[model samples]
Target chain A: MRILPRTAESGSYAALAGLAPKRRPSLTPYYFILPYLVFFVLFRLGPSLAGLGIAFTNWQAVGTPRFVGFANFEAMARDPRLGDAFQNTVFFVLLTVPTLIVLSLALALFLNQPRRGRAVGRVVVFMPYVIMSTVVGVLWTWILDKDFGLLNVYLNFFGIANVPWLVSESTAMYGIILTTVWWTVGYDMVLFLAGLQDIPHELYEAARIDGARAWGVFRFVTLPLLAPTTFLVLMLTIINSFQVFDQVYVMTSGGPGTATLTLVQYIYTTSFQFQKFGYGSAVALILFGILVIVAFFQIRGYRRGLKGVE
Target chain B: MSRTISRAAWYVLLAVVVALVLAPALWMLSTSIKPEREIITTQIRWIPQNFTVEHFQAIVQNYPMMQWLFNSLFTATAATLLVLVLDSMAGYAFARMEFRGRGLLFMIVLSMLFVPIQITVVPLFILFSRLGLTDTYWALILPVGANVTGVFLMRQFFLSIPGELEEAARVDGASAFRVFWSVVLPLARPALTAVAIITFLSTWNSFFWPLIVTRSDSVRTLPVGIAQFLSLRAGMVQGQMSIGQSMAGAVFAALPPIIIFVILQRYFIEGISRTGIKG
Candidate 1:
């Protein structure tokens, strides 16, 4: 009960009123934020700048680092593996994002209705999201194991041939995508659910009064109103897709042939596994560039979509 | 009549989706308890032919499962506590305290969110190694604590708090610390819980950094341990117990977060809705 203090009194208006006579600008604020700021400066701000600096050097976790301007970037541009890594990462994103958008929205739409077991359905869908990526990778690898995996076992039972889910280069990416969808679709669904709940009930009522049926109501009323959330989901999914590492690491280890090797996994191997720190940092910089550009456009779309809604 | 039929279809569809979502985890659980001989048999069995906790017992006995579990729990709990304290303070400062460069500082913190931590991995690893802190618990807790998401969450929550109560507290001769400690934080429990659940789950489930930093079996977290166990099995050492034990490791590694999610389901959902992203 002590922990649950009355929240009614702590509004912004109360906070504004709380400022008494401006006691001479003491270092109170600085003190309050110092602990967080220290760590942030050391870990985040410093590392980010250092990453940029290290990308221009040939620091291989040994001897005094020597600078090699753009050599790392130059080498990366010529590296076929880097190209494969980018291709696989984008392919993974393309496979996951659109399906996530359509499916999660559909789910949110269904769950928004007054249905029996709605809450349970929401919980069940989101369950995988909370589990560790490592666990998901392990479980799915077992399930999708080519010879003795459960999935093949089931397929064989259905009189279909084994699909070689994570084994074949062609199917490996799809296997990762399927696992990615099952693992993360719930997150996008929850966001959409929130967006769905935010749309005023009266908007739907107005559509109903206009004799709009289910599809009409959704297309005309719900979809337009949910644009902001949709845009946000798209942006987030793209960022997450680009940064995918854990599941790929555990499931395939960049694979039977570098089939599932993603940008992050590539950076991991190049830097840590192969001791190519400078080149890896350059690859990371490329990833950072891609993410920034995607975020820029998505944010612009978000604003434009919002204005249209208004 | 059509509406009724559609409703029935929706219910059926939901049942199917739920089963699909639950199946893999359920399969993991089933595999964890099944004897090794039956696990990879020709036929798929949802129910283990022979149910046994022997795999769990074997892994726990053979590997440092308890050590990894304890490392995860200890680090996650410590990180959560530290985050609550540091983030609440920083959040209060950003939201309420008037200071020079405050906007600039807060913007710097906010922008950090967009910079993927993976981008910083090499530098951070080098930095930690130089400081001789690699493979230590501080290696995980410190950087993870440094993340600005919790600070942002706290700031947004604290922004909604009105100034009136704090003014009254000041009128009663309470200091700024006292006001925040006694008046603000208690009322901020919902936000605190949301941040705590998120921080704990993230720290516990985090894999990438721990994987790179901890080169030894002694300091690795549960996820790292489970992943290593898996890779070892993937090397095909040919033990009857390997597959089941690997499944058991996964089950144990996933247990804390799952239990935490079930208990703090509302807060977890709330945190997601607030952030508008989950990564």
Candidate 2:
């Protein structure tokens, strides 16, 4: 809840009074910034601009690019694969964002209790996130294997039949989603725990003194105060889900029949694998557009919720 | 009595949660050590009947596992060091100095956060290829210097700290560079450590760019190498790497970071929580 204090004015004042020895109109600040600026321009800013321009061209790996305005974007309208990729990506986001929010919130609330051994639980839960994504993908594939997978073996104990997880078109996305949730829910829980800890304990004490029950305290006191963190977690999860690629690439290669084909996977295959740079860039731009629109709505909703709270 | 019951229930819930989270990792480790015959069996075996190091030995002998590991370590460390130096200086300037167009410049840098890296990859690839820098460490190390998060976090941290020490050093006629070097950099350790850990972790786990740029095993990092060769699909198609060996490769790639996380558990949690709260 701490706000960053404005220091620029105070810094100038110190220099004016000669309390700081820096002379006015000095170029030292520029000197400090220039080194990072060089790399930022070449690697980050310049490439972003170039990518935008390339989206309009008929660029390929071996040919001189010719300007072909809006052709690639139009191609997307007829490309069934791109359509499938878009739909699959949205479905992925829908499946993941809400589930991750609720599950991680539950875990945070459970672990935030003033009980013994909670730290161990927190550590254990966050352990998987430390593993590399590709390793996670490989490990989960074996665990979700049909005949001898650990998941099916345990399910049989509960009288459940074996579920063809990654090998079946109907169940492949679900398998990746399960792996993703397991790998990342702990991260969101950690964020939510930080938020919970930020709430003043006095509010809870007051709620209990007013004869509020546990559910009442949580609903009334906890939820309202936790809005900012919830908004942040939601945004982070949504953005990450929209860009889901690593596990899909490693686990199924968007396969069994394009069931797990995501936008980034499509982009990777088109540009890198097939050397259609322009089309890939166009798809990547569309992805950027989707992220921007989602972020816009999320921020607007958050502002409206804040106004309602006020 | 109800309090005691609730406490016992908490323990049970904790146990279940822990088991669910740890099972896959434990399964990976178990599979890595199990012999091929036991790994292929249908019966559920948490403990291997016969523990073997043959899979690990085979992967090491056949694949460039150690080279991939070294590549990951070298690039991630170089990137982290680069980000720390560059971000701290730029962060110091942004926090404490007043200059023309400073606010606008800072805004431009911050705007990159919304611009995902996917947009830049195509052009970045072309640029690197033109420079003939693909399949080199510079291809991996240089782009990381342009990261936005480290700069933002560093600037926030610098703003939060009181500027009295820097001022005192400056009033003693220390130059701007001297004040920053001796007076400010030491105080920025916590922020530096957080930025370093985040950058290192991401770079080490980075798959996409390395996959694009590197053609051979000489420059492929651990994640890319694992995804290309050790994945289940890869194993299935190539018919070379067994499940046990695949698991061994996975465990080989995973253990260092996991072990580091356990050792620096506090810093890892604190650093991650810091990013969330501050962002």
| DockQ of the candidate models in sequence | 0.49, 0.59
Chain A TM-scores for all candidates read: 0.91, 0.94
Candidate 1: list runs displaced more than 4 Å. Answer: A1-23, B232-241, B277-279
Clashing pairs in 2: none
Best model per lDDT: 2
- For model 1, how does the per-residue alpha-carbon lDDT over A144-249 read when each residue is reduced to its tens digit? 8878877787789889898888878889999889899999999999999988888899999999999999999988899998887888888889998999999999
The 0-to-1 C-alpha lDDT of every candidate, in the order given, reads 0.84, 0.89
RMSD of each: 4.2, 2.5
Best by TM-score: 2
Q: How much lDDT does candidate 2 score?
A: 0.89
Report the C-alpha displacement of residue B28, candidate 2, in angstroms: 0.7
